[model samples]
Target chain A: MQDLLLYISLIAAITYLGFKAYTIFFKKEKSCGNGSCGCD
Target chain B: MKKLKVALIGNPNVGKTTLFNRLCGVNQKTGNYPGVTVDKKQGNFTHLSHSIDVIDLPGFDSIYPKSLDEELVVDFLKENSGNSDVDKLLFIADGTNIKKNLYLLSQIKDLGYDIVLAINMMDVAKRKGILIDKEAIAEEFGVHVVKISARKGQGVDELKSAILLESPEMKTDKLIYLKPENHGVLMNYVKECVSENPYKAFLNITQENRIPEINVKKWKTEEAILRYQYVRKIIDKTIKIDKSLASDATTRIDRILLHKVFGYVIFMFVLLVIFQSVFSLSAYPMDLIDQFFSWLSGTLSSTLPPGSFSDLITQGLIPGIGGVIIFVPQIVILFLFFALLDESGYMNRIIFLMDRLMQKVGMSGKSVIPLISSFACAVPAIMATRTIENKRERLITIMVAPLLTCSARLPVYTILIGLLVPDQFYYGISLQALVLLAMYLLGIFTSAIAALVFKYIIKNKYKSFFITEMPSYLVPSFKNVMLTIWENTKSFVWSAGKIIVAASIILYVLATNGGEKFDKAETHIMTEFAQLPDSKKDAMVSTYQLENSYLGNLGKTIEPAIIPLGYDWKIGIALISSIAAREVFVGTMAIIYNIDSDEEMKITQRLDSEINANTGERTFNFATCISLLLFYAFSLQCMSTIAVTYKETKSFKWTSVQFLYMTILAYVVSLIAYQMLS
Candidate 1:
């Protein structure tokens, strides 16, 4: 039972991290309009 | 037939790299600037049918540098006069912050180079209601102005075309010329030889005014106030801003985030979250790596015959090298967050908020980044200290940096803490997490105290001022984060793996063969234990033989001294071997116990069952665990740190002193902990 619980928690954590990695790559915002954004 | 050399210069966080990468398309190499640790990048690409090489110089606000790193960039562009390979300069300017960005552009332009301006981040300007007329800017400056968004790869073609077609123009008659005596007559000589145009005189004047020499010092004394006055006048005429648009947004955000009272509270909260994520989020990948290595060792041992080569592969190479590689995931994760925080421009605000308090602790606000990065690993942190120019200040920062609990010490701390500290909560915080937090706090406080002490003792003839560019905040890019993680993790794993594998093989040989003396003692000890119960007798013989071996004799010699610190002879042996790298402590313990056991069990269980002969007590008790923790926390355990220090300081004496001081400090601290706890 302890092993099962550990495995479940591990899977959940991996899934959340995967979501974060995905969003970091895919998320898009409008180009900063003011040359001020410093994103050359 | 000549190749054009162009430098891309801009303020930090101004998408300079994004543009460089866009143009060069992965044809880039990264290294350090000559004689300094600042990151240097260079790349080449063919644009507008002309092959051009772009040098991405470290970002700075002015040509007059206040730090060693900034001086490197400025000196490279100005002092290398005979190297007329640079055909033109592409000055990247952030359109929204045109007034501040132009501060650097104007300085570069006055050097009398064929110049073109890449007004980048046009997308951001539109959103912020900033209107810029490209034609008007071009006409006023008498230089080509191209709009670009490097991140989106906008206007790059035009930028490339402009560079190919650009040519030097004759200077205007009204250009100012100041022939100050101390302006290094060498620069004037070079300028005259290089250019037969009117701008040569103007270039000489700008060079004389900017470069620091004996004569320029006197000129600065007389016209000190006029420098900024000139800057202001130029800014007022070239840039126009609507004052009504400057609102309380930045201040309002700073109120809650940088509030004197809440600032520390928020910092602690955020730091806690980062720590938790580093441990919790990385646990799965770490476990997977651990399991994979164990399986590989078992499979290789089973497949090969019982011979020296098989033993070396399974016992020496796989477990030894794999143990160090397993921690790569955690190190990469930690650096990923650091890079994200740095790229998003939030790191500058952290420096600004902590500046006053850090100054009181005898460190500049800039010292915070290097010190904080030490948590991930100290090698890069030590390298990062190059940004600090004051020799005394840099040395002090380097001295205390190792006190911060680095990721290399994490495995040891986690094992010891799990065995000792409970998991219960105190005021909604995990007890284990609080203990971890306390350990981190201890490192920080010790470092600060050491810095304060060093500040008063070390006297040097150098002056330092804290000036940093505050970049606007933006979301971090995933591509950059992944690339940084991959590069850092690959280097760390490869370097640490080689050392661990070679050390493991040598350790295995020493443990296995002790010459004729060990063989004779082992036979006698086995005969003496022959009458006892089989299991008990086996354990006694194994322990006896180990104590009589060469490694055992070395451990025994130091055992008497370390006993007061709660370590048994065997633990002393492990500690001595771990000086090569702290992660080896667990692996050494595993190997020692594995040789003794009849049935192969988990390394943790084997260590848990071992007992000390003298006290008839567990070797890893609360007092012993805490002592070990304090030792690893303060000691310079990695040889890589020493190598990096030697490279940075360029002296063996400094590195040796750093190692000696840290080792001595670790010993004293551990001794006190064991005595008090016991």
Candidate 2:
């Protein structure tokens, strides 16, 4: 059960970072300032 | 509603922005003007059944283009010259500098545009006992002159009404034409090229536009000389300065402030104060922020059912983001100081005074504002490079700006200084404060050297002109300063908050989950410490898990590369993660070391007690800390700055050159520091 949770958390974290990267670089949106931050 | 287009054009420091802010209020939008990198502000408002679209053009010195940025302004003007769509040119002139301001107006007048002279800073003029005969000047120029104090909300409605009520039929041929005695060839060429408007022909008689190069230079020089000679004559007749009503306050103060020897000393002292304030005064708020995050993490860890979700928030996310958000106070303070300098008009004086010295280093006096602003953050500082007309100097300023110890690096410095550097007093100064100031000075010195190198390397054929206007010093406006601080602080938080939060969670995952050894963290620590207390046992488990995790192995992989810098695997991890931002170094260290510890200690205490696995020596020793500092000082660490550079230059090639150069410089410098210290 513990191992499953750890894997889930890791995947979630990585997915979040990937989303951020996509917004910052690929979307070419102003992800840094004015609350856009590319997190979407 | 149909819209009418008009541009607000002026010399620098003429309150054009103030009037634009008033006209647009919350209705302004910024967009690039065609192909130029210069973003022009477009605003809209309804006045008396008319929807007005106002385009505030960047300030330029003269009609004759000196820089590409200035050329864009002329290009916009020339395109709109005979076009009926562009309604009017609202020429803003400084009341105090009527003559020089009028020179630009005179050039515009010669261009045969329907122009209105909006004389700003009338309040300042009135106080100085300098009175302008507006009607007389208007009659002389054959243009409508509206006296206004744009800053004080006085005569603004009148000016707006003047723009709104202005008819298309009012043509001003108000400029005095100069047919200099020696320039007969230029006059004849002007006569041959332009059949309709002789004024337009002479004004724009460029070498490419049907004139010889030699004749063009002679004609241009004569034109400027003639304009100034005409301006002097106008000033003599119309403007009056009452010496009794106003003492020469700015000049009297400038003598001590701008003294050749004293000026540099004063500048150094000002920098020393700013650094000291940042390091010493920010302790209280920084501590509160640190403690709050620690508590939040502790509460989440205890309350969230002892699962991965709990660990993720407590260990991975909170520490990661809390590290960056904590530095907001310092960032605000830094920007506030800069705003004060600018509003007080001392910023322009600094540029004026520093121009000669800066030229020696391949930077302009204009680069000073951007470079100084970099001490807070580099994104806006690079944006501020637009004011620098020289492309090569602007690029160099943008490239070297990050070397200045920004607010992000402040966290890294403060933490290390607290941990490794003792709170000893040296010559009546706190030793830590001295070290912080020294780091800042090092950044400045290195940036100077880098500019010198790039001066020769960066190829440019366009002439670099650094002529700057010296504005009279005034009391810093509290309202304007606060507005500036609020806007800048918002941008910093929004941008930094996103990266810090996302990176934290990701780093947390990297540190938390690992292969076989990490999975057996409890078993390994439990067996090794059977008699140890539960608290101690838990700490041992965290330490063990981190040492055995995927992150731990990854750190070990990079250890060899960073070993010469006196950094252990743990430091290597922090170093790698901190490439996202310099401040992330502290939080990465915090999350790795502070987990499961009962006592809510600061990251500084944890780093101080952290021992290296190989040698059993303390990891954050004097040598290691200094090496890390040197690396961060020279590194291209902030992704946002590199992104901004790419955006500004619109070239990946220049961006890569900047990144590679800074990284190489950081590595070499850090290696040297570690070798010398360790």
Candidate 3:
């Protein structure tokens, strides 16, 4: 049960991480300069 | 109804933005025209039951744009010319500085633009005892004159009514006429070249480099000299002012504010107050937020069914997000002060005061504005360098703009200062506040040196001139300040949230579990501490767990590279992770240190209590703290700033130069600081 919970947490974290990476690199935010890559 | 497009044109600091805010209220959005760095703000509002689209053109001395922003403004205007969408032009000017602003007004008039001259700051002008013959000026310029205080909302309704008076056909049929310094000499020549607005033809001729034109006059002329002479004649006839009162209250304020000896002293005092206030005022709310997050983390750990998933939520996500959110108080406060200074009309005075000192280091007074803005963030600050027309100076400004300590460094600084610097008063000021001020000062000092270095190395031939106007000081508007604070706070939260949350989850997953090596190490630690107290044994186990975890292995691999600077593997991990974004350092440190019980144990407390396994001494001593501070102070840990530099310069060469020099400087300086202190 402990190992199962750990695996579930890992999956959830990796999914969120994937989404974050996609937004940061692939998505273009309107504001360019505060901290995000200057794609505005 | 489709909005009627109107261009609100003006000189700098003439309340055009104030009028724009009044007209558009909350219905506006900021944008940039394609391929230009200049910010374009377009908004919609109802004026006399007709929906209006207002676009603000950047301020410039002459229509012949010397800077990129000015060039874009010209392009935007020409792009919208004669289009039914853009039918009216509102020319805004400081009523007192009508003489100076008339040069642009004359050019617009010569282009046969249907315009209403919105003379702002009339209330301030009236107080100073300056008077304008509105009827006479209106008759002289062949345009409607609206004397409205945009801040007070006086006579804006009349201005809206006048916008409708101009027939729509004038927008399309306007002829451009070129009025030379001596119109008598160029009349015959002008008659032959007459087209729809000969001045438009003149603009096309002179600005061929911008508008792309065929053969036209290769005219090298002081067109403004002629226009100014025309403006003088008009002012001489239609404007009246008492000569003695002309200097106004600004001169009186300048007497002390611009004094050579006291100016620097006063400036330092102001900075001390701003920093001190930021530290003190934010303590309560920041404490509440911190404590709440702590309780939340603790509650989750106890309430959730005992498992790794519960541990992940309690130990990782809550603390990681809290690490970044705790500094929001300071960010909001710093920006509030900046906005207040700007609205109070004192920021320009700061630039003026710093101009001479700045020029000694190869920066213009204009560079000061960008540098000041850099305190909030580098990307926008770097973009602010658009006003610096001299290519060399602008490039130098861009290169050193990031050297300033921005809000991203705030969390790192606050945490370090809390651990290293005692919370005591030095001469009635908080010691931590003084240390914070010193960090900002260090940034300015290093940037100056960097600017000086760039001045001699980068070569350029474009002429540089400083032409800043000292607008009359007014009480800052609270509405404006609140709006500014809200906008900046929102931007800071959104941008910082994205990276901090991502890095937290990634670091958590990496830190909690290692491979077979971690399992072996954990079991061995459990066996070794079998006879110890539960608390001590658990502490040892957690320590061992971090040492053998996946993130731990990575940190150990890099520990040798950082050991000389008094950093262990945990600090190494943080230093590595924060390269994603500087603010992530705090979150990285929180997760790596294996902190779970968020009770009253601040990150500062955790860092303060850290002990080296071998030496058994406190890990974050004076030498280590100073070295860490200097490393972060001098390093280019922000990816956004690099992206901006590349985008602006369109050269990886300059970006690499920026990244390398800053990194090399950080490493060398940190090594020296650590070695010296130890």
Q: Clashes in model 2: which pairs?
A: A31-A37, A32-B495, B141-B174
Which is the leading candidate under DockQ?
3
What's the distance in Å from true for residue B548, model 1?
2.2
Candidate 2, residue B80: the lDDT equals 69
Candidate 1 per-residue C-alpha lDDT over B211-289 given as tens digits, one digit per residue, 9 for 90 to 100: 4443654443333233444445655655564533434344345557767778778877876766666666676887788
Superposed by TM-score, candidate 2 places the C-alpha of residue B89 at a distance from the truth, in angstroms, of 17
Interface RMSD over true interface Cα atoms for each candidate: 15.1, 4.9, 4.1
Model 1 misplacement above 4 A:
A1-40, B1-253, B283-285, B423-428
TM-score-wise, the better of 1 and 2 is 2
- The TM-score values for the models, in the order shown, are 0.66, 0.70, 0.72
lDDT of residue B232 for candidate 3: 72
Among these predictions, the greatest TM-score belongs to 3
Please give the TM-score of chain B in predicted model 2: 0.71
- How accurate locally is residue B178 in candidate 3, as Cα lDDT from 0 to 100? 34
Q: What is the TM-score of chain B in candidate 1?
A: 0.69
Number of the candidate with higher DockQ, 2 or 3: 3
